[model samples]
Target: MSQITTTCPWVTNDPLYQQYHNKVWGRPVYDDRELFAKLCLDGQQAGLSWLTILKRQANYEELFFDFNPQEIALMTQDDVERLLLDTRIIRNRAKINSIIGNAKAYLAYSQNGANSFSQLLWSFVGGQPVINHFNVMAEVPAQTPESQAMSKALKKLGFNFVGPTICYAFMQAVGMVNDHLTSCPCYLESSAKK
Candidate 1:
């Protein structure tokens, strides 16, 4: 008989997905550039699956200058046109523009000096990760109050594609909230850190 392993219902048996789930998902990330990068990637996922974005992450980094807000903030229409010709990344004009726009927004928001982008983001979760004890996928919400607030704030800061649902997924990805199911090994590991 084979030993059984339990994981979040959303996870497939794919090794790459398994590695991301076990090592990266729900793990807290505080670096400013990394946070910015993840937010932009989540925005790219607005109309697509995350795996789609994940598969092209390296290409994104290459084209976007390693997610450097300063460099991306300077992207011009010419750059957008050139990127649109690339097949590795999604070719949506609106989506491509949003990343550049978001890079500008991120730079402006961080320059204001109210807080580090990480601090401002973490504030929405009371400066801690919100650990939920969900056993099934249905129990996880598409958007929460915190996500709504984050979406509103980001929009106010001139960010696009940061709707509440996308913000919620971003929160889960960056460990602002842990939406991992109790059956998943990572759930306990993540919750234990809180």
Candidate 2:
């Protein structure tokens, strides 16, 4: 018989989603570029499922110059119009523009001090993951005080589509907070890191 897998119930049986859940989601990401990319992808998930954004991630990378903030920051209205027509990625004009706008904001934010974008974000959690032991999916929250503060801060910096809910999802996705159920094998591993 197939080995029974224990993980967050949100994970579907699809190979792509499974891979993301088992290997990538809730895994701490310290790289600045990777963090920026994740933030933008989470923004794209505003009105859709995370799986939908994940499926088109490669296309996003290709079309958005591998999510290079410097390059994307330079994208103009013409580029937005063109990208809105591309079927490979989400065709929402506002969503597309938000990515570009966020890049510019990220670049500016990164210039503040010794900290990179990753450092700035992780600092909110005191440079470590806040591990929570939820027993079920219902216990998982859509937003938290930290996420609310993060959303406000990001908005102050000119980033869009970064409401509390989206910020919470970003936090979970980047492993800034471990929302994995206690019984899940990944929980122990995730909660251990600083």
Candidate 3:
């Protein structure tokens, strides 16, 4: 008899995506650099599937200074143009520019006394992850009020490509919220951790 492996239905058998779903996605990350990187990667997923971006994430890390805001802020137009030719990442110019732009905005926020990108982001959930039990995938929403507020705040802070929908995905990805389907084996584990 063939045994079954249960996970979020959206996750396929691809190792990269499977690893992301099982080991990374829905796991809380509080590091400033990690949060910043996830936000930029989620932005790049706009109009594209997350799988498309996942395949190129290592390239993004290699090119984007591991998502360090200061280094990304220093990237020039020439750097972006050069990156556009690389196939290892999504070559969209607008997305590339948004990453550079968001890095600058992130730095400005981080420079505030006792403030950090992680703090700013975690503030949306009031320093706790919003745990939700959704029995089915359809029950999950595309955006929540918290995410809408986050998007507004990010835009006001001069970040781009951070719409409410994208913010919700970012939230789900980084464990600002627990969105695993209730029946998935990972749901309780994801909710229990961080």
Predicted structure with the largest TM-score when compared to the true one: 1
Candidate 2 structure quality by residue, lDDT tens digits, 1-194: 12336478898888888778767778899999999999999999998999999999999999999999999999999999999889999999889999999999998988777577887788888889898989999999999998999999899999999999999999999999998898888888778766
Worst 10 residues of 3 by lDDT: 1-10
Report how far off residue 8 is in candidate 2 (Å): 1.2
- Clash totals for all candidate models: 0, 0, 0
Instruction: Please list the Cα RMSD from the true structure of every candidate, rounded to 1 decimal place.
Output: 2.4, 1.9, 2.3
Clash pairs (backbone) in predicted model 1: none
The whole-model lDDT of each prediction reads: 0.90, 0.90, 0.90
Worst 10 residues of 1 by lDDT: 1-10
Model 2 residue-pair collision total: 0
Per-residue lDDT of candidate 3, residues 41-87 (tens digit): 99999999999999888899999998988899999999999999999
| lDDT for predicted candidate 1 compared with the true structure | 0.90
Query: In model 2, where do residues sit more than 4 Å from their true spots?
Result: 1-4
**Where does model 3 exceed 4 Å of error?**
1-4
Clashing residue pairs in candidate 3 (N, C-alpha, C atoms within 3 angstroms): none
